[model samples]
Target: MAAELSILVVAGGRGSRAGQGLPKQYRKLAGKSVLARTLEAMHAAAPAARLTVVIHPDDQALYAETVSELAASARAALSAPALGGALRQESVRNGLEAIGREGEPEIVLVHDAARPFADPGLVARAIEAARAHGAAVPGAPLNDTVKEVDANGFVVATPDRARLRAVQTPQAFRFSLILAAHRAAAAGGREYTDDAMIAEAAGCAVHVFDGDPQNFKLTTPQDFARAMEQLKAPSLADLPDVRMGQGYDVHAFAAGDKVWLGGVAIPHSHALAGHSDADVLMHAVTDAVLGAIAEGDIGAHFPPSDPQWKGAASEIFLVHACRLVRERGGMIAHIDATVVCEAPKIGPHREAIRASLARIMGIDVGRVAIKATTTEKLGFTGRGEGIAALAIATVRLPEG
Candidate 1:
């Protein structure tokens, strides 16, 4: 369906509480500005909707820097930053007026850009509700104890929490109703906390739908720190070190098989069968190399169907991975591999395997360490049903 809605993102607040010199919306979160993530959420919610960001005049440089760092697809969707007014309401009115000059939308969504974790589903539901019922906003039912207090620290009475709801945006409304409401509020000097409150005071019924708790606004320095922590933890789990990558592979042993454990062909009574030679060590190492560059898994790059790879020696695959890392401006730091099996005492051949892999990868033997272990007659590998190999590769990229 053709979306006839424009998103007016109110991001111009000075954010005095955050105290980072930059507005809270422009603060870094997960290596990118919070506004960028908010914009991403808005676009994901409504891909076709026109997005207008209201930014403080002083924040133009900060906004530009943040948008420039975003992916091409995200940057392309952004319109130039429009200067906001003295208040958030005025800022939103400025954004609405600009969108009005472009083309009057069927509906408009006014949102706070500090809430980066807004759910796309909730936004969609809010828009649909507004389109059908005239105006709508997402809200979570208040579940905390409510107390009413007077000035001078006097407790009056406890209100019912069940009767209250904590509101969030994108607060949706018909274009005509919201524009007129904002104009009236602006003319009457009525500055409300949220757009829905303004609409409610203007005799407009604002429907409320359930919203997510994760959509809480990032308002404090601590909140920014938490977001940064979340981003780094996931990336760290995926990468142990700049000079190390780890991998593991396993295959079952069947009758009439030529065992290819590593890149080296080991003459055996049976052979491992799979999409490829099923060289556990090579597959594990290939994955480690790819992981270092954040490139993806081996299966994503090389599928089993390619005619050139049928029953191909796994060494060729390992060489290709090494070349890929080098091409991407990275060097192998070190790699440690281990083989597991009940039979085939590989302790004597560890040095040979290490030297062979080091030669193939064009690295020193010391940088490549290989070891073997037995499963102690426990499971599949322990029962001599198959062999498994684990590899860890350390790679380094030049620091910019």
Candidate 2:
């Protein structure tokens, strides 16, 4: 059987240096909080691992809000937050001890909450190294010459850059070994900067593995700005294919009391007629997403001629379209959708529809835009004969 794994996220710092009047982990990066993104990344890397977060006592409310921002699956993978101690070492120790009580895991990864880019490959390597060597840390090679300076700033000794590595976390270790090391350090009234250092002090031979340069930590205001810039506009080399697709769908009135739009049912005099649940908005959004990737439309994928698709929920179609985008190494950047209807007032359910689409697409609600309008009694929608929806989906795909 594979070894059981757990992850400890240390996020106790007040982030006085980051200068956002809030903890750096709680600060918004892109559309989500840094801590939320970190947790999501960790969950994505190790889907089976149990995760716990160490947070400052004063940040309980802030932490709750951050947790609410995560996707349901990611949030479900998390254990309750552990109250952090004054120092990073104490915070990690608290996390480890808390998880230990829930029954120990074979391997534990101690990660910094400020670092949100530890991809799955890096995490897999860390796990393999820990299992083989008992203790390991991810390390990137130093790119500059190193010097040991005296008190007056004169160079005392020059060190070979090739022999040194800049270490990062998600540092992995055997659960029992690290727990004992932390306990011994606490008993001796000693504090180490990181878990790897404590493991070394405990006479464990720590191994270093390759680390990604992009897995950098957020420490200063400049670092935060750089991270935001990177997210806003990742290099073309990473995502060179940006495409926008437009989709329009319409459904005429049928004999029913409700109509489904964007996965929400609204009470109406008549329902929309279609092979599926007749969610015009969701259909347009799905086709828009597929079109952005140059994939065929809804009919081409889930043909109305297929009996299995009859009466199926439109949410299923949108979910499949989003999955296809992900499988192609692409992401849905944003979705802008407009609903044209005369009978059912859409203003009351605008936010609900956006939330529903966001949940189905597995993206933030901020990336989805839902708008409603009518044709002034001019077209089929204006004639109350049918409802129509138009959508534009923006997506980013890797270069060929």
Candidate 3:
């Protein structure tokens, strides 16, 4: 039989570094306490798993107050708090021992209360890894170079960046393996930072799984300020509403001295054939913007079937789509488009197209990307018969 899973949340730290009227874990983030968010993630990952939340003896009242804000199911999922010791290692040992008394669960996940961004997928991966290898921790690859320094703060060595990883908690372990490891450490009067290290000291194999960049620990005062900014940052799922829309348009070559793309007229032997200026790029962008707001495509707004649009600039269509976004209480986050053509060489015009589109859409140039490619002499674009464009837009809006 596979071992059942359980959780041990260590919330014993004072979080003094985070500067507290309250512990950082108990502080509000996005209108909810950090610990509450952490618990919600844990419960969402494995509702059946037994939960043992460890805290400082003096923090019982604070813990109760925090637990009160959780939903009924979440409150019911928590076991009685385990009183922690002076050291973080001791606190985890206390949690492990408590689980042992209640009937040992086969797998246990030990996590910090400060990292509220723990996702259910990570939790499930940790549990699976631990069950296979007996001990595992989630970690992400470091983007910056790391160094090993002495007490004097002199850098002794710069480690290879490729092999280095910054580890995170929700360290998982097989029940008997971790319990025995912690028991051995306590018996020897030894201590370590995390359960993975303790398991490593006891000659147990430890493994690493991918971790999320957003699952950062809330420690320093600066981190709290950054968290506030992150709450406003782009997250498709966490935001009130985010939608993506795609657009594609094609136009055949016609007799003209210049061709228009993204509202910019470039000297060319042939122009795109369309009721409007035949700016495929602008038309694609317009459709994408319209689709994101769910107001239909460019044809719905300005049909080629309507003679008034004949010889009109495509930029006006794009502007109308953008206006609809504003009217719907939304903003465009990004627009990416690809142009397919063998003629009129898109290399020199790429930046111009992006800039022109940005100006027309009333957004920063950084938010737009215009790329060009050919069909490798395989399609109509390769034969120089027409130009085609594909685009996608990302938009953010208020929830209904």
lDDT of 1 by residue, 327-392 (tens): 555668788878888766676667777776775665778988788888778889887788888888
Model 3 TM-score is 0.60
The candidate scoring highest on TM-score is 2
Instruction: Give all candidates' CA lDDT scores.
Output: 0.76, 0.89, 0.84
TM-score against native, each model: 0.57, 0.61, 0.60
The reply for model 1, stretches above 4 Å from the true place, is 1-3, 229-400
Predicted candidate 3 versus true structure: per-residue lDDT over 1-400, tens digit per residue: 2228889999999999998588888999889888888898788656678778999999999899889988888888788889999999999999888888888888999999998867554676687678668899999999998999999999999999888778998999999999899989888898787888899989998999777676789999888877777566444453468888999999999998888988778889987888978999888888998888888998888788987567776766786687677556677899999989888888898888887787667578999998899999988988889999999999888798
lDDT at residue 393 of model 3 (Cα atoms):
97
322: Cα error in model 1, Å: 37
Alpha-carbon shift of residue 297 in model 3 (angstroms) = 27
Q: lDDT tens digits, residues 1-400, model 2?
A: 3329999999999888888578899999987999999999888667779989999999999999999999898888889899999888888999999999888999999999999977765786788788888999999999999999999999999998998999999999999999999999998898788899999999999999878777899999999988986576343357778999999999999999999988788999999999989999999999999999889999998899987567877876786787777667777889999999888999999998998788677688999999999999998999999999999999999878
lDDT of 1 at 226: 67
lDDT of 2: 0.89
